[model samples]
Target: MADFVDREAIRHCLARLARGEDRRDAGLIRAAWWPDATFDYGVYSGDFAAYLDWVVPGAEAISNTQHVLGQSYIELAGDSAKAETHVISYHRVDMGAGDRDTCIGGRYLDTMARRDGEWRIADRVMLYDWYQDWGAAIDWAEGVMGYPFTAGHFPGRARGDFSATFFAAGQ
Candidate 1:
């Protein structure tokens, strides 16, 4: 049905937004929002452009990051919809002494609108559920603490890392 299609499109848009952050791709992140879209993330409240400006560089500086999606509840009306998506974001920051792990659980409450048959977020409010942080010491040269003999086959999170190449080839 048309409603099912709309819901899937909305889900795809949200997933792309998360992928953009994980890959540190500004363009992909920008595509998820309309030019005048608004966002409130507790720590920052601003327009989509401002949100991208603030988030891009900050995400790029992190050693590694992942946004794990839990569940999404969407209510659809003719050309408008409201959605709440649960997320758990994990970040590893490398300091001089050691790496630190930061984990946050939150919900993205979004107002979406279809313009020219394309759906994008019109406004988003992020609600925090919980958060935690701890020091994560590891020997990257040999892998994690107990897995000393493991091999690092996966690529880094940087733009041109091997993962990108692998994904491109698969596509």
Candidate 2:
């Protein structure tokens, strides 16, 4: 039962971190990590604060992002745990020409610590498995298969995104 609880808490932390990136929510992202937590993503290696400074702006610059988490393999030991989570992330960006869709498949190797009864990441390392660059993003204006998206509510990369309201309303 304790293992199950710890695993669920760690998984939830991962989910929150992913959503934080997708929504460009710095505070949410910060909550997932310890102040001294470290990260290495090949391109950058730093503590949590530096990681936030680098990541938040990058997320803001991108038109959109969606992180799809597949599965997490966790090993628990007392108050600490190790987790490797599979992920596929999509990004829409302007490549100095037009909006392009890109995706990368990766895994997040994490060292998690349960402190003050809350589980948070103590360190993280991201490993890339594959990458694909799709030249152009589909025109959402044309909609999917020519059927328009429901008019008023569109997804956005900010705290005021539709999901926020949905969650705020206790749904």
Best by TM-score: 2
Q: How many backbone clashes does candidate 1 have?
A: 0
**Per-residue lDDT of 103 in model 2:** 95
Q: Name the 10 consecutive residues with the lowest summed lDDT in model 1.
A: 151-160
Please give the TM-score that candidate 1 achieves against the real structure: 0.87
**lDDT value for candidate 2?**
0.88
TM-scores for candidates 1 onward, in order: 0.87, 0.92
Q: Which regions in candidate 1 have their CA more than 4 angstroms from the true location?
A: 59-61, 94-97, 148-161
lDDT of 1 by residue, 1-171 (tens): 999999999999999899888877888888888889999998899998898887777743377788988788999998999999999998887665567878899999999999999889999999999998866734456545445534355335522456666779987
Q: Model 1: clashing residue pairs?
A: none
